[model samples]
Target chain A: AQSVTQPDIHITVSEGASLELRCNYSYGATPYLFWYVQSPGQGLQLLLKYFSGDTLVQGIKGFEAEFKRSQSSFNLRKPSVHWSDAAEYFCAVVVSAGKSTFGDGTTLTVKP
Target chain B: GAGVSQSPRYKVAKRGQDVALRCDPISGHVSLFWYQQALGQGPEFLTYFQNEAQLDKSGLPSDRFFAERPEGSVSTLKIQRTQQEDSAVYLCASSSGLAGGTHTSTDTQYFGPGTRLTVL
Candidate 1:
């Protein structure tokens, strides 16, 4: 079965600091990776996706993720995080056309 | 344009009761999906529908859970005789339904404000 794993349950970082969230996936075939951000009481918003082409995919809100095939990892990174960036981040992979598996998510807390 | 939308943003149901959640996908989306998210856990896939055709429902937890998209647009997820374990946020999403060819997966999926189901 295809699955996504996000190691960090929570992360605390000061405003303007760099942020990195780790994600590992297990799938038999090539995986279509995605990063989503969900603010408190809001729906999940797609930050970026990696289907093919460049391994490093840039997304909205200055987010970027690198798809490392050998390690089965797709880690999200932000050079500088804003205070408003504090939210839950989810890493997802599509097992099939409409079947997508998500990680437990990592809650980012930005210290002001 | 409007993104996905789900009705009854919050629902409180007693154990053994029935509950229904609604989802309206983005305009002209051919693929719809349903997911369940437990507290502090990521959303789990529940079912999938492509143009009124339910392609996969393997992710549904139990027989008590049912979903439908008769018009290939709006979708509904119904739970019968709900249990405490069924309490979670029910999310709905939609996509354009394009194939990923061989190894890759399909395109982006837009999500709605999930319906928080609380079984008491």
Candidate 2:
């Protein structure tokens, strides 16, 4: 079965440091990819998405993701992390219409 | 504009009980979806609805799970005789539909605050 994987279960980074969260998917064909963030007691919010064309896509909250077809990965990156950036980040893929499969998610903790 | 809203932000039920969770999608949204998110995990697709028609339900785990979107505005997910394994957060999402009630994979999905269901 097709699945999405996020290698890092938990990551701790100091405020103002650079951040990268990895995501990999196992699918026969290239599918629509997305990154979402969820704060405590909140729903999942779309941070960025990559459908086609440009490999690098920018999203809200100063976040960006690059889709690498060769590696089947779409990793999220931030030039500088903020204290409020500490939350759970999820990587999802849409292999079919109206359906999404998400990874286990990576929990980010910002240190002062 | 109001985002998707779900009722009963939290629910606790006995092992053999049944429960219904409601979701109110954004106005004029043509697509609706239901997902199950367990603790420490991402949301898993459960069902999909195109307007008043249920286009896909292959993600539902078992027969005990059922979802309905009547009038193309509000949706409800019902779990029958819930089990201990049924404890999870139920998420609802909506996306703008294309003309003729069709939607593609690229549409951004707006999610609602999930309803946490705990079965003891």
In the order shown, the candidates' Cα RMSDs to the true structure are: 1.4, 1.6
Put down candidate 1 lDDT per residue, B1-115, tens digits, no spaces. Answer: 7999999999999999999999999999888889999999999999888889888899899999999999988999999999999999999999886533533255788999899
DockQ of every model listed? 0.63, 0.63
For model 1, the stretches where C-alpha displacement exceeds 4 angstroms are B99-104
| Candidate 2: RMSD to truth | 1.6
Interface RMSD of each: 2.6, 2.9
For model 2, the DockQ equals: 0.63
Give lDDT per model, in order.
0.92, 0.93
Error of 1 at A79 (Å): 0.3
**TM-score of chain A for the candidates in order shown:** 0.98, 0.98
Residue pairs clashing, model 2: none
Q: Write the per-residue lDDT of candidate 2 for residues B62-90, one digit (tens) a residue.
A: 99999998788899999999999999999
